[model samples]
Target: MFDYSEIRQVTSRDNPLVKQYIKLRDQKKYRIELGLFVLEGARLISDAISEGLRIEYAFVTEQAANKYPDTVAGLMKASIIGTYLIPSSLGDVLSATQGSQGLYCCAHTLDKISAADKMNTVGKYLVLDNLQDPGNIGTIIRAADAVGIDGIFLCGCCDIYNPKTVRSTMGSMFRVPLVDDMDYESVISLLHACGIMTFASVVDADARDIRRVHFSGGSAVVIGNEGNGLTERDASLCDQEITIKMKGNINSLNAASAASIILWEMTDEE
Candidate 1:
């Protein structure tokens, strides 16, 4: 257990740690440089603690610390570096969410999976191509976790550590293994080398129906961007182009929705 007496209380926004929090909340480059990302809200912080993620620091509003003593104690115990108390007003300024949950933590970023790591795993996977929305990426990660995807390969997607994305994952972000920022060609080569058949999700008449497509061995289903779908070049690299069947003028689905359907169909669950 953490010693409550050791908690440092900071009222000034000019505090060095507070400044670092602001930078981490706003800039992706800062997070990259520090190799740390900010997780806000009690639930997310608690999730990080439960997952045994290395927490560099934790900051809680004074009011929250008082109201939730047990939670504050838990955070203090989980914090490897230290825990600090900030004024509620300062908490509002530091918060990315609208209401300000009064709890925040800084955690080390998970390393991106390498080609060697990808080659060792053989199971269903999801490939995201140029997906821009943080929420969509997070939601997809959550769904991928639910359906037992072996891994996720992100090509030109938004930062997975983006606060919105982190919140949307509801802690699944910590559970999922992700390969970040690879080009289409390299990903395809790696998949093929691993003997994983790739299926491209497209909206074309020539594409095979998703239901009819056989997922025999290790497979990958690719989901494209929100507006443009997959680039022609990327779509051409896959073993087969597949589409979810639809009717009544509804030809497309949101990226997350489409991925969920594809993941469900591809899932080996009985």
Candidate 2:
């Protein structure tokens, strides 16, 4: 158990650690440079701690401490170095969004499954190609975790540690396995090498209806950007082009919505 005796009270916003938290909260580049990210809200912090994430530093507002004493105490015990009890006003500087929960923490980013050989041969996977929206990425990660996807390959997606993305995952950020740095070509080649059928999700009428295709073992669906859909080259490289059959005039689904559907279909056994 982490030592709780190290908790300190901070009255000034100029505190170096406070500034560090702000940087990690707002700047993705800085987060990547330091290999750390900031998580806001007691629930987010608690969830991370429960996942065995060691908190480098925890900042809790006095108001939050009174409101969530047990959670605050838990943070004290989970923090690896120090826990700062700060005023509500300072919490604003640490928060990325309005109505801040007044709970925050800095933790190193989780190691992802980046090595090619670490991936198995017969597991379900999701490949995101140039999907930039952070919220969509987060929602898809949550969906992937719920549907028991084997892993997620983020090929040119936004920073998975984007504050909005992190919060949007609702703790699934800690649960889902990820490959945040792979390129499209590498992803496709790896999947094919492992004998996984690559399915390209598209809006084309000529594509195979997803309902008719059997999601056999070792399936991976490539979800494209929200606006541009799949690139021509990407679609052609895949084993099959698949589409979710829509009714009436509905031509396309939202990225997150579409991914959820495709993931369910891939995991569903007929």
Candidate 3:
């Protein structure tokens, strides 16, 4: 699919491109500045490609080429600026995960939903407020996709493009529509303008029980941070406050867990 002679070899860890990849992986600021992010694993790269994200650069270890031959062949067909063949040992050193897949690549950030264009006026949506845990963020993204959420608004959350978060999504990130770095007021305003009902998922005992509430219209459930939950002002801004009715005295849940339950209830056709 591509010229074998065109593939470059990087024998030294000191190679400029190697350093650049490492920086993109390690530094969020650098990723933002370069308009690029690094990803590891063959399936993840394939997922990105399937989602129409371009591969700018790729690094493949010899072992990776041998094991994932079909993937390598497909990668050859990709419109990449540079491709490097590295040793397995170096791949191990550069790999973020304990067991390296030996295939890695860099791609520009995916385009996301923005205020410039009004989002869908119908379908379920998720709003994450100040969620700090990358794992939680990624898991929520996966859950949102699984439950068929129309879009996700990430407000004051961790960088969704963080390598760990990206890996945790298990390729779901490529499927789910996302709006990052949004604030509460903007999210509320946008949803209201679109005629979507906004429900704040909170721990308040007096809040309506989520299971009993019928979401008959285009709706959004606002999930809060891992530690503090939502501020009173944010919750009050929503049309209504809802809570999961837990057994016994359990009053709170993990951010991702809460979101999944609320999302399921919100979208439940039964």
Candidate 4:
């Protein structure tokens, strides 16, 4: 096992690896080139390990090594390649977190889910149409994972690779299959052909109440933008439009919150 003590200490900001890390952290190109992304904190690291991500190197503070020895030990054993004990100051520079958690790692970015011959039949799936908030996307991902949704479609929205989305997911980004570059028409036709009932989630349309809808077959729910909701084009594609009956005075629900409610109702028991 590699000792936690001996790895090269990176103090200078000019260190090549540190420079690369900064680039990857700040820009998207480096992440794509290295096929890697940075993950911070103990919880996210643990989740990455659980997802079987290949962690090439880990940087932890000595305090973390002592305080979370078991976590450090797992990081040591599971990170067959190596581990490093970085200075707290150095780790602070390396960390993307608002508050450094004493642990950080470099792991390959989640592999893209290919579109060709994509599996059409699924127990449950979600389609995001022009949803702009990264946090909302991440929360939807976590909800999808919790409710046993097969995958997600990010249609005409923000990039899934955005760091905020990854962080918000709490590592569900690693588990859920997501496709971003999808066309609306193709998505509708494909799901329809596979016997999946596609439901568009919107407010006060001639839509059915979510409680009344049957989730008996392969199912996919479509959620729209936070500001504008679903486009008329995407909305027209759904076999049905569904809405959660909100008793409160609010006219509509936030896209992510609404999605979680519907997903729980549709897939939680199943």
- Top-TM-score structure, candidate number: 2
Q: Flag the better candidate by TM-score, 3 or 4.
A: 3
Tens-place lDDT digits, model 4, residues 80-161: 5567777888888887777778887777777777754666475688889888898999999998888778888888877666
The digit string of per-residue lDDT tens for model 2 on 75-188 reads: 888788778888888888778889998999899899766658677677899999999999999999999999888899999889999999999999998988888887899889
- Provide the lDDT at 128 for model 3: 91
- 103 Cα displacement, candidate 1 (Å): 0.4
State each model's CA lDDT, in order: 0.86, 0.88, 0.85, 0.79
Measured on C-alpha atoms, candidate 2 has an lDDT of: 0.88
- Report the lDDT of model 3 for residue 42: 85
Q: How many clashes does the backbone of model 2 have? A: 0
lDDT of 3 by residue, 1-270 (tens): 333575678878898878888898899899889988988998888888778887887889877887887776666667477778888878876788989899988888887566538577777889999999988999999988888888889888989989889998988999998888677798899899999899999998899999888888789899888999999999999999999988887878999889888878877873
Q: Name the regions of candidate 3 deviating beyond 4 angstroms.
A: 1-6, 116-118
Q: Looking at model 4, report the run of 10 residues with the lowest lDDT sum.
A: 1-10
CA error at residue 115 for candidate 1, angstroms: 3.8
Candidate 1 least-lDDT 10 residues: 113-122
Distance (Å) between predicted and true CA of 60, model 3?
1.1
Question: Per-candidate RMSD vs. true structure?
Answer: 2.1, 2.4, 2.1, 2.5
